[model samples]
Target: MASNLTIGQRIAWYRRRRGLSQEVLAGLVGRTTDWLSKVENDRISLDRLSVIKSIANALDVSLGDLLAEPSLFEWSDDRGSHSIPALRAALTDYRQLSPMAVRIGQEEPPSSAGLASEIAEVWKAYQSSLYTKVVERLPVLLAEAHHAERFSHGDARHAALGVLGQVYHAAASILTKVGEADLAWIAAERGLAYAQESRSQVVTVSLLRSVTHALLANGRYDAAIQLTSDAAALLDDDLPKATPDLLSVYGTLFLAGSMAAARAEDRATTRAFLAEAQESATRLGTDANHAWTAFGPTNVAIHRVATAIELGDIQVAIDIGPKLDTSALPIERRVRHALAVAHALSLWNRTDEALATLLDAEKMAPEQVRYHYLGRQLVLSWIRRQKGKPSFQLTDLARRLRIV
Candidate 1:
């Protein structure tokens, strides 16, 4: 019986089958012969998905045939001597779970022997979570995926790349939540490059959208708009089906454009963009997939209210705000909560009620609340400046809302 071969041995086997020495193979693949020698000797590591595919193709063998070993044990100098066992154990724990359990645990299981299908499934689940913003569990999932990539061969390497791209995108998103926009952009760019290498158009679009969102959040709205336009142009003339999954992204981009117009105080442009978003929502039809249902009619209503508030159309904001559904919104989306508070204050001219709403939102998500609540604090200060004494109830609320 043939002994189980490590990835390095498989590469050596393929190289020998082609009747090419390490020097010749290295030249064909555009690498120094020493690099190929180290790979064959298991002295170096390979993680890039594209390189693995190139080797598999050159050897005229399926990736699965090249990576048939069920287990891989290896040494790595860069990760510290102890890191390999820890990583292997982690991968082992990951592989033991059923797919449903993996979902519940918020992790992607190590891919089974076949590569492409498994990676695609994991990518689908990851995309679904993005719409609902339940991505807190992504980092651990991604770390395991990186471990799996180290030993992948053939189609497995492609699968690993697909998984790595998802991991990068998820990390970028988490970084954005923690206020690290620069790192978020870098991660996003890396993910996009990998997705392109994978030849996955859907993943490419998703990464571009992430990049646009990060740019918009960082106040680089012009760049954000340009990126979105370029991505849209790259898509074929055919539009993707109006699934809620796709609509959430499409709707969010429209909302971002409206927000940009509002920031510029371009009332007409803002209204047009909001109208476009509402139209997109209407086109989505009423299919309620939890993953896609996040950006529903309520989101459109909130955008309208926000545009009105920004345009100084207080009456319009008041009229539309009460009709908007708040049930779908997570308590952590504090900017939306602030919009609710602003609308209520305008409608009743009741500082007390508005103060209460703001206080409640601050309690729910204090960190997120600060972004728009700072403006609310300024408004309260102005009201107090004009009045001989601040509303005592409002003052109490302000005390609670202050970060320090």
Candidate 2:
């Protein structure tokens, strides 16, 4: 019976099976009965990682159990699909290789400048909604960058190592989206280690952002916020000398910290960090994709949509939805922003529009929009609400996502 329930309904079932009343379970998790009731009714989304973990612990279930669907592709009960395991193996194998193995002089080395161009191309591909391509290319890119770093010296070695860190950071992000939180953590840690080796604050911040995201995915909201906050504190004395890139990185951390706070239900902290980030965005004077983060005024607006939805401010999210321009963002950013709008539209009883918005996201990034757990969950909830037949669009999406 629990296996047939939505995540919210499953929570209620688990609480009842565990012989805990809503009030008792709420008290156990330090939440009010109203919050618990809303969650059980699916009136509010259980999006916060901390909130999900609390429910899991109080119900004595694992996170995987809480999120898993009978339709296997809808969610992973383990480390997701084979893609994640393969990605993990690649990272592990790369890390374990002997230094001598990477110094391959048998083939002509690509020019450092050309290798750098290829790295940019990879980032561009990722931003353009080529996640599968990015994942397919990463292992080789990482190996080549490692080999390049092993044979180079001075600025060449430094640049090569920086590229290595960037590739690892991208790997962490891709892994997280594919539902491999554990592997994503390792990728992020490795990226951070490589960043430290490069001794670049910009590189460090980029990797740190990925680490924070992986932490969020793992329900370590407090630690994620603390890590980003501590890093932000380190930049205080150097604030006057901060370049646009540094300021953008500072803004990126604040944005991430804001998300962590929102996940923890700390609205005050969320707003405070958002304000700080807005100041930095203002300094940049435009919505630039600094350090490939897309952190700027327009980017903040997209986050505002997400934050509003997370905080159950459906009206707020709806109000800000139309102001976003799909053109101002990369394809991935557009998908993210569109998903937030879809969430808002879904909650506002605009189910048709919500489904349309989701379809738009699918058109942009077919694979990502198809496999994401939240979108599938939301559609399933809607399907359950249908009096007779589900709409064809929703049905097709569910079929594609394997949630039927």
Candidate 3:
């Protein structure tokens, strides 16, 4: 008699058949090898429906196939037209309907083409939404499309690479904001690799910038500066005069270098880098002549405020912060809130006020808020030690944010 197999056992068998080691499979699915192992061994359960779908897709099996027992299938009337192929078809149908299923209380029928288009549309919307500096939902959308197996063909693979790169970049940013620098670094590196494979020079440049940002977040100022310089040099000027993508990339790199220099306390170098960024921003036009038209004056101003905060020039940060029209800025690039709050609190010697500002920023987006909070906490801790009591609420905020 054939033995009954749990989902974990089925996953293990299919994984081995696909000739993928746990580590390799885990990387593809953005999971840790240990977690995959535990799931395979039944030591842990797959509670998230998304994880289950991802596993099924990676194994090229149906959810039912993974759940079915060999002996029971042979003995049941329900076995008619219930081969792996049929089960796979059904699984595809279910996965395609996932997004709609997640929305209203209605159960919609699935369409392969419709699912692909929906995924593409949602991905574009997510990218657009990044400018608004809001993105707690991007990761979920990317993961859903990833598990839906909506990206298997050549064109789909290219799209997947682009989506995955953006997802990883966003994930890295969120992780860094939450003070998970190590995890952020890993995600950024993975994103950069995928962007390169997609041959999307613009996306690759963005991913590289993200990596530099991660390095800076981790206090690796020198490394971040070096990486930003290298990325800048790699931008080919011959690409196209109308290509704002390359120009936008250069602007971002310059901003990164400026931040790094500020961290290193090199005032002259920071000013020089900021000047370069400003010049690049000025050159960007409304015509299709630029590679990334997204890097406008607002973006430059946002960076200026950030660098000012980093350099401990509270007055400059305060002056520049309000000048920025954040309404035009991307959701992902909204660094002003933390910068303004931190600068005001620090300069006014109102540590309590600064802590509150940081807390407010955190409430906007915990992941993004953590970046400002970490720096503020470091400064506050030193100040508290010098004084009698711990005035700033860094410890409390850190605990609430799960940073400690």
| Tens digits of per-residue lDDT for model 2, 122-166 | 888888877666666677777777777777888777777777888
For candidate 1, which ten residues in a row score worst on lDDT? 127-136
| Candidate 3: stretches off by over 4 Å | 1-156, 239-242, 285-294, 322-325, 330-335, 350-404
Q: What are the lDDT scores of the predictions, listed in order?
A: 0.55, 0.78, 0.58
> Is candidate 2 or 3 superior in TM-score?
2
Q: Once superposed on the true structure, which residue ranges of model 2 sit more than 4 Å away at CA?
A: 1-5, 9-27, 30-50, 60-65, 68-82, 94-112
TM, every model? 0.55, 0.86, 0.55
**Residue 266 in model 1: lDDT:** 65
- Best candidate per TM-score, number? 2
* Model 3: per-residue Cα lDDT over 1-404, one tens digit each: 12234456667888898999999888878999999998787655443223565677677765334533221112135334333223223223544345344444433333335444554444344334321121334444445535433435576666566656666676566555544456667778877887887677777888898899888766667788788777877774643563577777778778878888777767888888888788877777422223323466666677777767666676777676645566554443544445454555555566566666566556654434433333433343434334464444666665553434
- Model 1 Cα shift for residue 243 (angstroms): 4.0
Residues forming the 10-long window of minimal summed lDDT in candidate 3:
67-76
Give the C-alpha lDDT of model 2. 0.78
Error of 3 at 390 (Å): 11
The residue-by-residue lDDT of candidate 1 on 1-404, one tens digit each, is: 02234456678987887898888888777889899998776555343223554576677764344433211122246433342234224334544333333333454447734333443444444333221122333445555565556556777766676666666666566455444455567667767776676565555666776777567445555576566556656643535554455565566666767765664466776777677668767777532333322455667777777766656666777777755556545443334546454544634566555566666555655434443323333334334334477665555554543411
Candidates ranked by TM-score, best first? 2, 1, 3
Query: Using alpha carbons, what is the TM-score of model 2?
Result: 0.86
